[model samples]
Target: MDDKKVKILLGKRIKQLRQSFNFTQFVLGEKIDINQRQVAQIESGHSFPSLSTLVKLAKVYNCEIKDLFNYNHLEKEEKVKENIINIISNLDKKDAQLLYAIVKVIREK
Candidate 1:
């Protein structure tokens, strides 16, 4: 995969993992000594974390660093949709409702 795709997949994975742990970007950043903005950027796939940062994040999430870069599952568009569904399924009803509305609006455009 291209570098941009790698960044996006990694970002999505990190975001899903972070949400599963109930860690806000700021809280996770604090735990890892990164700024919240950096976390946000990382989650948006706008910035690729350095190797040391990846190690810290992997340790925080209790996974191997290599697991963070597993791109096979992320290669499919359906996998991306599935990941989004998984994330939304974990959210509160109100947020999910809002997201549904937003998705409807976007799809209608």
Candidate 2:
């Protein structure tokens, strides 16, 4: 993926997971020892986090670091196939290709 796409993907995933646990930017920042603004930037895809910050976030959120990024592409695809075939069928070729690649990597693990 391109740099912009990667950033957006990571940011969206972080935001999704953070909200899933009912965490505010301030609360998550406090747990990770960063300011809320930094958390905002992370979730907004305006900045990239250092490895240490990523680790801290993973720890604070009680998730493995792998959960912070786009590792769920495969799982999402499966869910779509099982539960949302129309949505999956609507995806363009590029998206399907990307999903296929992610599924391949996930299966390898």
Candidate 3:
């Protein structure tokens, strides 16, 4: 992906993680020792966090720094579908059956 897209995706992933942890931007900023405006900038993709900030964020979120970059769910729907298809195609028969069952359960929900 392009730099802008990567930044946007990373920002979204950070926001998702923050929300999952029940943290507002102000709370997250306090944990990371930044200001709320800075946190807002990061979440809005207008500013990228420094490596130090990332380390602080990982600590605050109780996750590895790499986990903060797991932004595949922020990809375009078509790309996501293609990735899922590729993964499914590589699965063994038994795994495929299990996956199908899981998907069925999810769909029912």
Candidate 4:
């Protein structure tokens, strides 16, 4: 892919990862010590992240660097995860605790 396309692809992958982790760009930028505007630029493909930034992103997303470039259908999965987080968050503490336990059990398997 051309450099522009590559940058956009990276942005999309980063966005998907961010959504899956329920992180706003501002929050992610804070973790990586960059301004949220820079994060927005990166996510919009208006700028490319440096290697160090990429490393930080991979660490924050808990994925291999390669995975960032390989994202496709994962966008749907990320959206689902985002929705689940939003729904679970609105539940009462007792219900949220039960949901968490169920998720943990499912994840452990």
Model 3 C-alpha lDDT per residue in residues 15-45, reported as the tens digit of each score? 9888999999999999999999999898888
Residue-level lDDT tens digits of model 1 in 1-109: 7888889889988988899999999999998889999999998999999898999999999999998877566567657788998998899999999999999999999
Query: TM-score of the candidate numbered 1?
Result: 0.68
Worst 10 residues of 3 by lDDT: 71-80
**What's the TM-score of every candidate structure?**
0.68, 0.62, 0.69, 0.64
| Tens digits of per-residue lDDT for model 2, 8-109 | 668778888788889999998888888999989988878888899899978877888887875468446546768766766889999989988998999999
Full-model lDDT for every candidate: 0.90, 0.81, 0.90, 0.85
Clashes of each: 0, 0, 0, 0
Error of 3 at 56 (Å): 0.5
The lDDT of model 2 is: 0.81
On lDDT, who's better, 1 or 2? 1
Put the candidates in TM-score order, highest first: 3, 1, 4, 2
Q: Name the regions of candidate 4 deviating beyond 4 angstroms.
A: 72-109
